[model samples]
Target chain A: MSTPKKILVHVDGTERSITAAQYAICLASFYHADLTALYVINTRAMEDLLKARIFLKDEQMEYEHDMEADAERYLNYVDELAVKKGLSITKKSSRGSVHKEIIDLVKADDIDLLVIGELSRIRSRRDEFYDEAERAMRTVPCSVLVVKDEDKVWEMYESLV
Target chain B: MSLIDLVVEDIVKIPMTSNDKPDVLRELVQTLKDAGQIDDFDAVLQAVQEREDKLSTGLENGIAVPHGKTAAVTRLKLAIGIAPNGIDFDAMDKNPSKLFFLLVAPPDQSGPHVEALAEIAKLGQSRAFCKALVNADDAKEVVDLMKGE
Candidate 1:
């Protein structure tokens, strides 16, 4: 705690992720903390699909490229939002199990705080089991903030801009 | 960007005549230029060479991706060459490389290029896939294989 010096946000291309990013940017400005946003490409799942032959080799490659593009698009949008508030934030993307990547970076970088969007609504035990963001929240060893009340967070973001 | 969207018969050379590394690189880059995927052959070649000089793109499993980013292409472009005979490209696995993927792009457009590189790496994991591509008889066949046909 001691006023988190490094803040990490996990973006997964969801509407809630954007809300989380905006909230993180606002908080970074407030506390002068270093903010870094990360997106993991879920190569683990892609490999599983390949193993099942659900995706052909070429299809798996193409799908990975598309996912990478998605990651870049989301990261760039978060960067633009941070820039609008005159804050320079770090953006990073990795390819692996989403939750594992988040946990790894949190441990490696000694992230003081981790911010994430609202957890996906769990439809079943398996759904909760597979939700990477929810898994990341449970696994990362740091203060976790789950941004909700999208309208209120959006208003705060607009005020900063 | 889907790797298949950039995949085409015009840019693929099967049973490549080139027997060596430099020639294979030249042949693949030339394929891109011939297909109008790149305009400045010299710049594209140099960029690829510079990248190769720094580190070999030769990966294991008979795959080699020689790539670079430059103003030669407006977007990410790919050219593939299959050398059944294999050539020494200083591969990490120390084996000759048979599949060559030449990629060029605008300097600022790195996302697609990196994605393409990762795609090739992922594709290398499948021996069956690599074998199918290597055994392809013609450019159309190669394109079809890459298109996942």
Candidate 2:
């Protein structure tokens, strides 16, 4: 309800996540709020590899290193966008459940508002529609804004020329 | 890159006349050609259409960002179109898309293209900003809103 003082955007490699980061930057600029972009590496996926013994010991280490690099790369891209706008943003990365990390970060940073993209990869399952977003929305302490691209009236003008 | 800087003034159509996606894209692609942003309008259109064929750029709420990486543009080019009545864009949310951000860039210029796309995506999230853009009656008003003036 009140002007947000601290805003966090969940950033991943997806286009939708990039949209969320952009929305967060705008909201942070308008409200003069501190902005942070958080990227989680999905440690659970790595754990699955461990359980399956897919990679040998040395290979596992290499895989983890590559994944870490990817996380930093994504975070840096977000940082670049913030810098271009003449605004500074904090970039954070974690390794664990995506929604849990976000929820924890919200509490740890005293985040007042959380911005996220509306759609994510759909899984082929009985409850295909429910995704991490549903969980994050239900549990996060701060106000959550799921940024969705909307149709505006202005896009319709046809060129007479 | 600032979305405002990339906006071709002559092409920022408000209440864009085309109701369907392909025509709207054609109109915008022509805008780029008229502004001299792209050399071959048909190539750029094909590229953008190809991108869309992969997946609908129709994002939820009301925005569609149709983009392509092609040789037609030497640098990054952006055109904004708004349709007050909304058109069926086959968006992920299945809602009619009213605001369009047409991004065209050379295949090598992924950096600028991504930056501008991110900037537009962020700007699109603001209900207040979108409202102001919708109420804007002319190109100047639209440009001013993007400039954050």
Second chain alone, TM-score for each candidate: 0.95, 0.94
lDDT at position A160, candidate 1: 85
TM-score of chain A of each: 0.94, 0.80
- Residue A47's lDDT within candidate 2 is 55
Which consecutive 10 residues in model 1 chain B have the weakest lDDT in total? B108-117
| A72-99 per-residue lDDT for model 1 (tens digits) | 8889999999999999999999988878
Q: Estimate each model's TM-score.
A: 0.53, 0.49
Off by over 4 Å in 2: A1-161
Give the 10-residue window scoring lowest on summed lDDT in candidate 2 chain A: A152-161
Which residue ranges in model 1 land beyond 4 Å of their true spot?
A1-161
Pick by TM-score: which candidate is best?
Answer: 1
Q: What would the DockQ be for model 1?
A: 0.02
Candidate 1 C-alpha error for residue A61, in Å? 23
In the range A1-161, model 2's lDDT, one tens digit per residue, is 68999999987555567767777777787788999999776555445433333223553454456557756887898888777677799999997766799999999999999998765332222121234555677799999998776221112111101
Backbone clash numbers for all candidates listed: 0, 28
